[model samples]
Target: MRVFRIAKKQYLEDLSGEGSRLFGGRWNKKGMPMLYFSDSLSTSLLEVLVHLDFKHLTKDFGYIEIDIPDNLIDTKLKLKDLDDNWRDNPPKSITTNLGTAFLKANKKLALKVPCAILPMASNILINPKHKDFTKLKVIKVADLDIDSRLIVDTK
Candidate 1:
C-alpha cells in the first residue's frame, strides 16, 4: 500500500521526521517526531489544512507518496473509537515507554518501522528511530502530479 504526506516546501524532501520530533504534536507531546502520511492526496490536504495560516500559505507546498512495507506492523483505529479517557487524560509525554497503554502500544508498533497507518485525518506517525525505517522511499510531486486549478479554500 501507499501513503501520501503534504508539507511545506522545506520539508518536501525530508524523510527524517525531524521537525515533528523536535516540535512534538498532539499525539506525542514530548517530541518523539513521527513522519505523518495520508491515504490520498485529498486526505493529505485536509490533514494539513488545520495547520495552515492563509497568509503564509502563499509559500510553496507539495505532496509526496511512500510505499509501505508488507512486513511492517501498522495499527489503524477510527478517531471516534479512541477512548474518552485518552482525550480527557492524555499522556504526560510519548517519550520512551510513557503514556496511555493503548497509545503506548501504538507507539511501539510505530517504532517497529516507526509507522502507524492510521486514517488520513489521524496521521500516519512514523518513528525515525526504527531500524527498518530507512527502507521507506518517497516520490516528490511534479508539476503534472497535481492540478492546481482543482484546489480551493476550505473556508
Candidate 2:
C-alpha cells in the first residue's frame, strides 16, 4: 500500500519519527515515536495545512511517497471504535492512550486509523521501532507546490 506525508523540505528525508515523538500528535503522546501518513496526497496536504497558520506557510514544503506492504498494516480502526470525543481539538487521552498502547504492544508496523480532518479518509500511523519498519520504502520525495491562494488572507 502507498502512503504520503507532507513536511518541511529538510525533514522529508528523516523517517526517524523524532519530530512526532518530541511534540506528540492527535494519536500519540509525547515521547512516543510514530510516523503519520495519509492514504492520499490531498489528505496529507490537508492534514498539514490545517495545523499551519497563514503567516507560517512557506514554499519549503515537500511530500514523501512511501510504499508499505499491505501485510504490515495489521490493525485497522473505524470511527465507531473511537471515543465520542476522539476528534476533539487538543486531543483526548482516550485516543492518545489507545495509540500509546498500540505502540507499546509493538505487534504491527502500521495502524490504519480514521483521519479526524476527513473521517472518510484514513491515516496510517507507523511504529518506527517495529522490526518490520525497515521493509517500508521511500519511493519518492519532491517539492510540494502548494497554491498561493491557500495562504492568502481573505478577511
Candidate 3:
C-alpha cells in the first residue's frame, strides 16, 4: 500500500476523540499532518478509524498507520438546515470539508477513508521508507488518483 502524507497545517478538519482543549491547544486551526488512501480527498475512504489508536510514533509503533477505506460517497449536501440542526443537536463529531479533504465523526457509514496520523516533523526530517517520497509530497485532494487508489512504491 502507498502511504500518503500531510502537514499539521494541511489537515482538513479538527480531530475527534481529542477534546477541544487538547486538540485546539495542541493542533493549530489548519489541522495536522495525516496519511490515508482514497480516490479524492473530497469523497471517502475504504477504511476509517476503528481499531488503530495514535500516540507518539516512536514510542508507540514508530509509525502510526491507517487504512484507506473503500467507501464511495453518493450525494453531498451542505443544506443550511443541516447547520440549523446544530442549534438543538449539532453533530458531536468534528466534521470538516477543507478544499483538500473532508473529515467528520458522523460521516455516513460509507463515506470516510481510513487514515493514519503521524508527526509532520518525522515525515519531514526522518528517513521515510521510500526515498522518492519527497519532502514536498503532502497529501491533498489533488494528489489522490481519481479512482482513490494510492500510488504505492512501484517496487
TM-score of each candidate? 0.65, 0.94, 0.20
Candidate 1 local lDDT, 3-119, one digit each (tens): 778777767778776786686655564555566676567666655665665444444776778776745645544545444343332322332233223234543434221212223
Best-fitting candidate, scored by lDDT: 2
Model 3 worst lDDT window (10 residues) = 119-128
What are the Cα lDDT values of the candidates?
0.54, 0.90, 0.25
Clashes of each: 4, 0, 15
What is the Å distance of residue 12 in model 3 from its true position? 20
**Which sections of candidate 3 miss by over 4 Å?**
1-16, 19-21, 25-61, 72-105, 109-155
Q: lDDT score, residue 73, model 2?
A: 95
Q: Tell me the tens digit of each residue's lDDT in model 3 across 1-155.
A: 21333223233322231332233211112342222333322222222222222221111111122332223232343333133322222222322232113232323222322222321111111111222323322332232222313323333
lDDT of 3 at 125: 13
Q: Highest TM-score among the candidates is held by which one?
A: 2
- Compute the lDDT of residue 153 as modeled in candidate 1: 65
Once all C-alphas are superposed, what RMSD does model 3 give against the true structure?
A: 16.7
- Candidate 1 has what TM-score? 0.65
